[model samples]
Target chain A: MTISSRSGSPGPDAAEETTVIPVVPAQDGADETTTLPPIDVPVLEDEEFEPQADRDATFRPSRAGWAARSAVWLVLAWFVLAFPVNFLSPFTLGVSDVSAASEAAIFAIVGLSLNVLLGYAGQISLGHQAFVGIGAFTSAYVVVDLEMGFWFAVAVASGLGLVQAAILGAVSLRLTGLYFALVTLAFGNFAQQTVFAIPELTGGEGGKEAPRPAMFDSDYSYYFLCLGFLAVVLFLDWRLTRSKAGRALQALRENPRVASSYGINVKAYTLLAFAVSGLFAGLAGALMAHHDEVIVNQKFGFQLALLFVLMTVVGGLRSRSGVVIGSAFFALLHSGHLLSLLEPVTQTIFRFSLVDFITGTIGLPIEFVALVIGPILLLLTITMYPGGIGQQIAPIREWMLGRRFDRHAGKVTEVEVNDVRA
Target chain B: MNLPLYEQLALALTAGVLRGAVYALVALGIVLVFRGSGIFNFAQAEFGTTGLFAAYWALEIKGWGYPTSFLFGMGVAIALGLLTERLVIHPLRDSSRVTLLVGTAGVALAAIGFQFWWFNETLVMSMPKINEAFFMTPWGAVVTVQELITLGVLAVVAVGLALFFRSPSGLAIQAAQQEPVASELVGISVRRVSMLTWGIAAALGGLAGILAGPYLTFSAGFLSFGAVGALLPGFMAAVLAGMRSMPGAVAGGLLVGCIEQLSSLSILDGAVPGAGALVLFVFLLGVLLVRPQGIFVGKVATA
Candidate 1:
């Protein structure tokens, strides 16, 4: 496997002319001089010399290639797995499927957005779920009480998210790291209280329902809808990371001071990053509202915020695969059937049902897999394999191919390596 | 709306002072952790709730009764704090502040999970009545025993902390905070000092929780809210003390408490139920903008 390094700076050949000298003590009555050995460097052909070109040729695929090959393969796999479950399985494709998939999509989007903030921007936001909650409530109000169409509700939700992020970004840009986290946390709690107090708008603890579009009444259609949104978001994310703005964002993420010195507008870029992330999160929340047909306060609590953060960290934030893979893994865990699979084993070993085992083991309600699993996974990832599963497997996959998995490099390059150090 | 000016003023002042005391106690716990470890204790409220639950268990489950249960609960809380510091905080000593913060959050979540597991979902602790009645005044204002105790506790803790800081161990802790390597050279154990700090902080938080639990409902959710409530006042206290001065933290806590209470009683009555939080946000913003260091002191570098 060929590994290409990005170019540093080009400079004149000063190394050849430089001579090595050594100093000796005056008491020794001798001036010591040493000559350095000449360096041996490999000379390569023009084809081998062009590393960037070689890397690009090896990895970058045309749009048509992905659409025709990867897209088809993904679709086939989805159908293969889903067909049996939908038709042959005894379980009904009712609220469970819709809830699980929708929640996963929402979390995935939240994770993706956080990748830009925490993963890319090097900023930690403990209150990011506040934006998600805001988006959910906005869409719920629009779709249910205002009787707006689905698209309009989504658009409005995204718009509100943009505004909220803009305000937060402006307020918090001056603060660094922990202070920024604190401010955002306060804002999140404030938002939560505001939502609670405005019972007229949020329906208080009772919650409000968001009617789904006529076309997506069935679980299959709803799942596809969610998948479609996921696909678009993934594409947008891919496109974003490739653009000038994306590179600039990455630069700022690494070192805002350095990026600013290089003529990048730090504040503007930070605000833009926050807004874009909020937009995607809002879209996800809007979809969640429609899919669940309910907007409850409990769904967007602080615990959920922490869960989203944990998912992003566990998913190898900054890589599309990391977010998608982590989302799917957690989604399956959240499903009741997955938990039910352990019932017999738990019953035999612990003399308790799976639910009891889960409750005892995690010290929380068994239903709260997201809470228990998210934090534990976060701790495990940070303490042990901070690069996460996607990162750990990437090298292995490349090694197995022998020719290097260059095609995946572009998506993986954005993953923050420094987080692993922490 | 048409209340006499004198009555309105008295009510605002009394409410501010009472609320301020609660704020101070909560913030004091945060101050202890921050000063000793150089890390913000996001789990302060959770720790407090753990103490509350322990107290609940002693009183309700073990049938240890009120005052004894309270003492038992505090003892349990101290053990939990020591265990947490040893297992979680100590191992993460060299990690980045961000990682430490996130780790504390995990600890907070775990604490909540434990609360959920031990306590029945629907069970609520019947808080002992420490204060039964309020003394009415001609000015249409009343002072309750609960308010008095809350303020009294604040006073005692503040004074006690000041006195402790004057002791040899306190000096050692101060030195440890300033220069751990140097302090170690001078024959101080940084680890022991930190554990002591954690134990004291947790104990303070537990006391606050036991005192406040009767006022607010005790539940698994209480920790999350309680932590948040503690944040602003505690943070303000830390900032005011330059994050280094004990007196500054105390004064800052009292100020935050007063502002929050006054805001809640006056402007926030029916208009904004989140007036306390709003006031805190404003105070934080002001602190950050006008004097990011603090009102009375400069920035004190944490370990």
Candidate 2:
């Protein structure tokens, strides 16, 4: 049928019609005498083949559903804001705890940055620690040595991230898959051993003292600033995924050859994604440096990069909420304060601190909890649940978003463990 | 030209060769696993570190004889390799190569954690050198006995691999690597070959760690990112072989080593901190950008 024959909706009459797919009998069609009648196969109705836009009609919740969604959103806002500020909450948060919360928010931003490349672009970056590290050092140097304000420092850091990432993206034009991974790995080592070692830039062993911005000096205010940045990042990420370039990334990632055939500039779009990812990472890094007040090179090591990857993977590749949660979980875990908070739960569960329990039962020291837990979660995430935490929480998320809480809501439409290796 | 400058160049060259030997040893394992499984195993370095740690415990803590400790270390390495193949690789065999790479990385992380747990109390663990003597060159470059022995070991391993590839079982491994389904159809158990390949690779990694550990003050993840960050260099060496050729991997390792040693030159070191890593990073980028197929490998259009 021609395009003109298709309608917005199909009538019942179309259901009666059928098409047949040829059924070849006998091995290699050797037994021609045993030919059988053609079998009927289902054919797509004109309405079924309508434009993709018409098919994905948005779900409109009822009045009560809308109210519930509003309530849920309000709770989410309050939880994120008041919990960190220790205002209008059951318990007050200390300054360091508030700082940890800020770090968590920054980590969520960094995780989102990785999701753009690994999730949407189907590209891998093993040297992401370097990306974040460069941003951290850049911002620190700008703020401390150059004596610039926080806003200018963040801008310069993000620009550097964009430029460096674009250069790396250019490399991806020639090399991909494992080769690209190797290059990133090399770059990470370079950043760690060489770039971070520059005495002037990193400010030697004590590191550069990246004091908080004048206005947002208190932990409470800085937390809000980070939250604001995270909100901006989240908004940008949402817009990118819905934008033309984002769809192009998804298509090219599925099959570059076909995408190129369809007139997509594979190199240009991939570079755009790299720039976007790098921008967010740089912004997050700058935020993190200021969060600590004293930035050091040791924080962003190879293991940190590895943790970032597995955390994102474990969070679920393309799921925004999942990645953010996973990133926050790791950031909290890394800071050690999260474990202390969990001590009460562990005491009730195992009569000792979680670290002691792990050492006594699992034979692992407390210092390496994430080192062990992260991997187990990663393996489980990839093998059994490719959707990660996002997939697991999808049904609840759908319900909260004014949709029916269907049991199979989070069914993995696509199972990709970092693409199909080209 | 000044004689001192000539001596410095000679020393750098000598150091590069010795360093490259260790990289080549690690590269062999990388190439083996990549060929047999078509997955880039990031845990290769951990296998080395694990073996080194196991040996350290035996020789130092338990006071086992050197020969027995060496055997124990190799045994541990083989066991760990087999376990990895069974636990992580087997479960994710049908997954994407990237997923497999992630799985191997998980294995590496677990090993690193275990090492830290066991050796957290110990600081700056050092492996005893096999021999104390050193051979001095005319240019004043000192070559330790351990370095000479490592070079000799590499030669023997290369020759052994050359010979193995010619044997029946070796041919089976080759067949399995090149065409797993076809080899299976012809009665070759691809599973056994896979296990064998990983085992061999792990042993090689272990040997590299045991030999190289003496050259530096070692710790957990030593081969991966410690004082001797051999993993990336080893990978570059494998990339130089186009991630395929066995003999080419060793040669690539030596080349990478020599190039890396260039950063130790006083001129570069004085000019910048971490000059060696900068040189390595530039070299890796140059290699992939310039000749991704490697100098020795034939070029073919690929996805």
Candidate 3:
């Protein structure tokens, strides 16, 4: 210490000056004596703090994109296959029976419309069949009474349906799930009463027959026509799921609060979703009216509404394929074949009509299979596979690629399942 | 089209109030179930129908009943209610509100189907005419003993339920609704409480149905009709009450009944022929606009 250092050692100049400590710690806990000059650290300006070049990379779809594309392709292929099958098959699948296929297609349309609202939007509508009825009634009136061309009738019917939906949407826009459901129920009943009351417009209890379009002279042609409509509806559905509006609707379904926070006009979107859904429903009704060559008030009663809800729920509300599958299954069952098949068994067991046997045994109608089964399936899906059948299949496809399905690996939590439930 | 003012007004009010009381009773039954549990009890009318049919069987068909067919019908209704609660509602205690509501609807449909299968005929039952002695000419309007009984029963039940909720067991029941998990954790047995609620609600519905049966003849489709009547008023009441407060439910019911009666006397009688339905919609819309939470209760926090 007494020895003179390079700069100073207990010198008067060093003692008079202030010694500044370094803000940063030394790498090692070693002490060394050295003379050092003052250093100036350069401060980077705001312009120097730029994001990485990778941040400007071109947009890329997530893994969900490929899965969605495959789904779309699969749907298109199914439609292509169904088109010929609908034309060739007769009422029964037994011998040239296209009736069953055509009926399935018609129901498929109804189910799809319901899927748009109940499935994608997560709104429960008990009055969907009312729209169907309105479409049928309007189209029937136009085609049969107004003597409008079939396509013209369809156009007019769809327009009327839009108006009906708008009015209903306006009235029920403020209502939440259950109250919304009740209002729709009341409207359905009111429609029925009005139909019955206005015998001049509707044939009332006697019912009225609708004329088939000239284009579809034969059953095969009618089947093809229905298939065409179904195809268009299916395409529209595909487009909807892919479109921005569809995503917005889906966002609302997932979490309206979150969606609204992102500046989505919740009411406008809800109304739009409802209107689009009604448009499809109306189209289905118009097709049905022309297909059956009859439109009855009874066709759109509360029971039909219940059946429609059941169909959508059973088909797996989140998937278009599920809706179609559910609809087809229900239509086939409704064709009375299932009941006929069970006739012998029913006779032996209860000695009653098939309706009685089915309804009495389970204390629920066959139409209510969805009601009885849907919740269980939904619960199971919620617990085990929260994403429904569509999302569940992705992992299998990924596994086939010799890769572990790790997209949702750690992100899939119990809370996510509860959130989906909500 | 041009009836005397006094006559038209009196008749309209009379019909409205009388029908309104029936609506109130039916609605009260629905409100009970809704308040106890979140379910709308779509089968409330069917419960009434079951009672009516049971009364018919006991009084007219079997002819082995010491009591009047009316009393017998009430008994059968109580039994059916208990059975339904135990068999159906009890098992579905943990179901979501929508599921439960749909379940009730299913019950309704099954009940209707059963009635058709069993009865085979839709013939209406003819009960003994209610005596007119109890009726008095108030403002030249005739009010029947049946209507009085309906109003009285509604009052007693409403008051009784209010008192019941204040008791220790009622507090447990309320606790079950407020915090079902916590109540369960505390060994309160949520399922048992729900079953009890179902039983009580069903019995109230059955009683209402039996009382209303004599006025509107019993038939297979009677319950279906009754369900509509019950649904409108009950739904209105529940919505008005914010689906929580019992007092709110009662007040909502009375208000609906009165409004319906008053609307019948108004100019709207011609425009919207469904006066009762119109009144319900208007009131529901009004309440939802002004106070969606309901009169006495606050906003419906759960559903």
Candidate 4:
């Protein structure tokens, strides 16, 4: 490992430099600087050179090797991104499957929203379902009631999300840590039960129609439309981390007292994070509504909120790719495509339908798989792998980006979000 | 929807006391766990549900007597509490409170999943009440023997906890919570204290579940997220107690219960479909805004 470290870090030179520096300083003052022992010099050199063989072992592929790798990567991207609409699609992705894929994209957006709050801001929101639910209902209302354009409906939904989130932040941001989590939870329940209860807006139990834009009416086009929105959100998230506000939010998360001393407006930046999160959530919700072609209040409940948190944490906090992949995994899990894809192998080997067999044996519902297994994964993520999916995939990501694939490249530092000064 | 104001007030009071007993029971366990662990244990209510499920399986499926099933259920809750402390909480002891809270919630979600797996939604189940006798309150409202039992158990547990705190083991728990390192230096087994705290908290939770189960149908996460869930209300009560006081938690529970039941007034029912939920939301906001610290207790020393 140390020999491999030659290409990545400065271990070899630093050790030699340390030994030589003490000896050279003896010229300044022989009494002040103690000379190193003669025996210690060879031992140090041998220690530095012991792992020498591995320095040449580190993989650095040739031009042709790079070309092959890039070609393979290109085909993989094409298969994932475009093959479903093209004739070469596997698994025979039907129209509903395409719609389900759109849901996956939208879920990625939602997961990113959560990453901004829970990961970047170090704030917990168990009630985030209300944020998305409101966005979906608001967009549905704008298009159905006000006869607005699709973009206009989306804009209005985003605005409402920002406004509501700002109000919530203003009212309860003073409540730090778990108290704030409790407040948001109580508020979420209130919104679901009361604010959403109004028939004019949420349309009660009957639900409301949420039609797709005219240009993106087909399932394939709508899926791309959602993909386009996901790209926009991803771009915004990238810009956020690179901006001054993002840095300030990170500082504040580290220590609000110190951040305040440094002249950062902790409250404003927190509210800003909240608003940004709300905007993305609202946009995702709008896309989800149109993708479903209808919206209902019941779909946005405590379980949905819990699932949002699950996907975000499991995606690897502060990692866009991790969040997206995790969200997509869950979306497929929920849609049952991932399970159905495994049906062939299970049928041939086990000689029975896996889903039906489980349902028959344990009486667990199909959708409950995420609920049952998600928390266990989350527990594992928190305890054994703090960086989650992002950390696991980081080596590959770095290798693709022309960097040495150091095993610890994406290791997450301690994110102790306590009122205690850690 | 047009009942007399006096009748509404009377019914609200009666309903509040009965409902408040269960909330008090749940709140006491929550406060106990928080004091011992310095964490907002979100799985507190789930403990009750676990016990309820255990007892239900024993009674309904195994055809065991009520007393044996109840003890088995309490035993299950204790085991779960021990597993949680050892497996989840102990491993993540250095994690932030947020991470710890999430861990507890994960424990809850896993338990809920197990419940759903073993007892699917297809089975509609309810435990038998302790008694079938009904009594009339002066408010013209009906009172059940089960409710009286719940109230009696709450009283007994509250007094018992007070006395326990004065005992040697209870003092050990307090020392462990306040000065874990110092207590360890002095030869107190802080680890054992943690186990003891969780076990007792879980036992209290088990009592709440067994006593309250007769009032509603049993299912997965029944005590945590069901229609008869006491989780949110229990938290509210703990908050009202400044997250520290024991007796304060009891009083706060009654206050919240009455406030929640007040939504059952005909006027409120006529105006809103889920008046109880709306009232709880508004009242929680009002209390937090007005006091922030607590109504029943002095300033909280820690977060």
Which predicted model would earn the best TM-score? 4
**Distance from true position, residue A37, model 4, in Å?**
14
Write the residue-wise lDDT of candidate 4 on A1-422 in tens digits. Answer: 01112123444455465446545443555455456433345545655654542343354777976886698789868866786576565546677777778888999999999999888888888889888988898899899989999999999888888887887777667677787777777877777887778888888898889988899999899888888999999999999987888788778887789888989998899999999998998888888888888788888877787788888888888888899999988888877776776788799898989888766776778878877888899889888887789878887776676555578677764444565320
Candidate closer to the true structure by lDDT (higher is better), 2 or 4: 2
Rank order (by DockQ, best first): 2, 4, 1, 3
Worst 10 residues of 2 chain A by lDDT: A1-10
Model 3 bad stretches (over 4 Å) = A1-104, A332-337, A341-422, B66-96, B121-144, B184-187, B217-221, B224-228, B258-279, B295-303
Question: Scoring each candidate complex against the real one, what DockQ results?
Answer: 0.38, 0.58, 0.17, 0.54
Tens digits of per-residue lDDT for model 3, A243-334: 87777877776677888898778788778777878888888888887777656666765667767766665565556666777687667676
| Candidate 4: clashing pairs of residues | none
The RMSD of every model to the true structure, in order and in angstroms, is: 7.2, 6.2, 13.3, 4.5
For residues A108-168, could you state the per-residue lDDT of candidate 2 as single tens digits? 9999999998888877888999989899999999988899899999999999998999999
User: How does chain A of candidate 2 score by TM-score against the true chain A?
Assistant: 0.84
TM-scores, in order shown? Answer: 0.81, 0.90, 0.73, 0.90
Q: What lDDT is reached at residue A41 by model 2?
A: 33
Across B1-303, the per-residue lDDT of candidate 4 in tens digits comes to 367999989899899989998899889988888888888887888888889889988998999999999999999988988888998888888888888877888888888888787777646679898797889977689999999999999999999987887788888888888888998998889899999989999898888888888897878788876867788899899889888788889998888899889888877775866677788877777777787777889654332
Model-by-model lDDT, in order? Answer: 0.69, 0.82, 0.64, 0.82
Query: In DockQ, how does model 4 score against the reference complex?
Result: 0.54
**Which DockQ value does candidate 3 get?**
0.17
TM-score of chain B of each: 0.89, 0.95, 0.85, 0.95
